[model samples]
Target: MLSKEEIQRYQRHFPLPDFGVEAQEKLKKSKVLIVGCGGLGNPVSSYLAASGVSCIGLIDSDVVSISNLQRQILYKEQEIGISKVRLTAQKLKELNHHVEIEEYNLNLNSKNALSIIDKFDLVIDCTDNFPTRYLINDACILQNKPFIYGSIYQYEGQVAVFNVNKSANYRDLYPTPPNPESVPDCEIGGVLGTLPGIIGSIQANEAIKVICGIGQPLIEKLFIFDSQSMETRVIKIKNTNARDTITGLIDYEEFCHPNKNKMVKEITVKELHEMIENKEDFQLIDVREPHEVEIATLDGELIPLGDIPQNEDKIAKNKKVVVHCRSGARSGQAIQYLQGKLGLENLYNLKGGILAWADEIDPSMEKY
Candidate 1:
């Protein structure tokens, strides 16, 4: 039963014909687990808490960075480097003290995914990576719990409801994980600041619908939204009996990253600095976008990742070539492509990319 204060706080919700006192009470009794307390997680948790979900469990191991300020709304500029889950929990409590916030300041892995997910009635996939997404899917399938999946890339976002009443799971839509190199995260491929807000609110709406037993949730349908064009599409998904094969959790990292054994060669920022000091002959290629170069760069020849294939002639073949990006991921991808497609033997990824350079070699360099 809602207290007098609780009733007053959620008075706006009490008026909806379909969502009345009983629905609000249902919300107050529901437990939700949100994985990845970044972008999407920010608005999902915020609206759910504000809507009076009884308990919201937040799980994320990341710390706040300046880059997160663009889309992650719950954090402040002053809170940089603070634990994401910790600050998010504090903020959610402040928003709705009537709601309980459980913080898990650790990465979700195979060992803990089932145990943690078992605690919540429903799970929301706000995670950016594929490994965690697959992990959550399998864990939820095993636990027989439903999950709302949301993802944002550049100006586009996707939201889906999986395993609700034994409906289509993520694997039914994507039988296998895509190549990790092909899928650049929000950090590599930027997202509009407001994109998460749009998608996450929809996810929260679906969650409430699921909890309250009101309107039709996004079951067996994938909702895609493009912020640039303000367009939307819903695709029907057919279950392929993928869940029948799921006996237990496997190493999601290995599952998603099939080429994990083929490691890319790397050179530390400090080593690059030493080579610069010694005036050694080497080619430093920046694979980051042009805008990222304006933010912070090591003055390397600008060759964006997309252009790397055509601009291979520009990269030095005789001298050692070190490719870099904002962080090392993109550059490593560039190196992998060069090595595989062109069979270039002299390429090395700048370990940690320009971020590492800023942290280790140059204190004055701007970091985004």
Candidate 2:
């Protein structure tokens, strides 16, 4: 039931023998939910909308930043300080107004995963952390929905399809999440800006195949790509005993490794405000780039996360150093870095990062 204009808009795709008006219509009818609108989510969500997916739900608890402009193609410099979901929704609608786009500006957690996945036909896990990935996997399995998973580290990326029609799941491949400290992020390890783009596009293609019901889906197979060597390899995964243990969606973080994250140095938003008021003899350091401070807070010292190791001498080892970034993600790494280098036991992370401070303490402060 595409109108004359709709047919004209997608004329290029309709003529393809394998993907004609019927496949396009199927795409127009399918609902795909994308989690974590950051690196992989940005490209995956954009292409799905441009390809005419009828309903694309984006779930993210992040905002646009200047640093993200390098790879997250959907955002622009002007959109800095805006919610990732808000800006992404506006742009995707402009690209293809024919589709429906839903935005959730809240973080994904065990409490709301089921209700969220229940609304979409398939879920795409573009999240960066292991805890969130495991949560998405368990939710998809519990809801009996297929999920496309994508992850990138430095110059390498991995993509796979899981929990489709009771097929092999994430747990079937990796029984437990890696130790949080053991896995370094793109921020610390440095990822190629174009890495997620390549991986996310593949994820979008997998979702289209899942919806069109054509081509062999990447079931029980994990595809790994290395941009440096320009090589692609697929690892075949066999069913594991972990499948039998997952009767229902249990706590993913605890299931991964209980008490492992108990040592994470975190403080509540309230605790931070109290420190600022009491004028506690502590340095509230903002580890994001200098440009990021123009849009966000604590207005503290600017030592980008990348330069932490070299700039340790600049930090006050005697006084408490309360470190933070856009979200609490980078600060945790920063605290860990300092502890290992200077053994600064007084180092603390601004819990939930500056975002929590913006939400709880100072709403007037721009959230970027």
Highest TM-score model number: 1
Error of 1 at 214 (Å): 1.3
Candidate 1 global lDDT: 0.91
Clashes of 1: 0
Off by over 4 Å in 1: 261-263, 277-279
lDDT of 2 by residue, 114-133 (tens): 89889999999998878788
Estimated TM-score for each candidate: 0.93, 0.81
Native RMSD of candidate 2 (Å): 4.0
Which stretches in model 2 have alpha-carbon errors above 4 Å?
265-327, 330-347, 352-368
Model 1's TM-score against the true structure: 0.93
Worst 10 residues of 1 by lDDT: 256-265
